[model samples]
Target: MTRIHCLVAAVLMSLSLNLQAEGADLYPLSSPAEQERFQALTEELRCPKCQNQNIADSDAPIAKDMREEVHRMLQQGASNEQVVDALVARFGEFVRYKPQLEPRTVLLWATPVIVVIVGLLVITLVVVRSRRNTETSSALTPEQRRRAEQILKDAEAP
Candidate 1:
């Protein structure tokens, strides 16, 4: 049982190590512009499989395919926008690090700023309310203090 567990662990470690290996630049470019475009697109497009990583930096098979598609489209004289739109159509807006500001995606772009503003407002309100409560609670009239003490004494006696 231990030997089987050890073998499984070794295989998993080896697979994880392979995942980190850099994928070679296998797509040959005929022009410097194509090369630059390829580099930019790969860096700009996110890997569908690795949500956090751009296609250029990811070793996932889907990233490899996306890179190949971008190279092919650029070779055929597609504009950067054309290539990006094609990828977005296939993989959804999640493929772009910065999705365009369409009505559907405006919320996606605005959500972070909105969340931060809302959070700040909520925190400010909480801080103000707490300060007001403390200020109001801190000073009691002599009559109120005496009444509170009398109540406490009655409770203790019961």
Candidate 2:
């Protein structure tokens, strides 16, 4: 009974492994160059459904469809730019992992710099105000100077 159970488990494991191998086959490319390009594009493109994940890393249905579309376009002899343009037209700049520098995206690219500049301005204002306060408090009017000198003299006499 033990030998029979071991034989059955071995057969089941072999069958599962074969199925996985079949499923893992990549779409055929015309050449090694095309395969490299396909990989680069997939890694660079973001999945519309999985906003934070690139298509190569995402398992979302939209990502799967996008992968299929890219494979189809590459097989049909589409240039890298052409394939990217098609996707950007159908979906939007949001589908790109690195968006281009454009008027519409200026704010997105500049926000960090703008924030740093604003923070520096605030710190300068605070420092200047503090110094002004310190100087004003340290300076004495004529009457205040006389009063302080008199108090010091009285203390010395006692």
On TM-score, the candidate that comes out on top is: 2
For model 2, residues 13-81, the per-residue Cα lDDT tens digits are 999999876544566788889888888888889999886889888989888888889999999999999
In the range 10-60, model 1's lDDT, one tens digit per residue, is: 999998777654333477788777888899999999999996999998989
**Cand. 1 TM to true fold:** 0.66
Cα error, residue 33 of model 2, in Å, equals 2.1
Q: Where's the lowest-lDDT run of ten residues in candidate 2?
A: 19-28
Model 1, C-alpha of 59: deviation from truth (Å): 2.9
Query: Candidate 1 — which pairs collide?
Result: none
The per-model lDDT (C-alpha) reads 0.90, 0.89
Instruction: Please count the clashing residue pairs in each candidate, in the order shown.
Output: 0, 0
TM-score of 2: 0.76
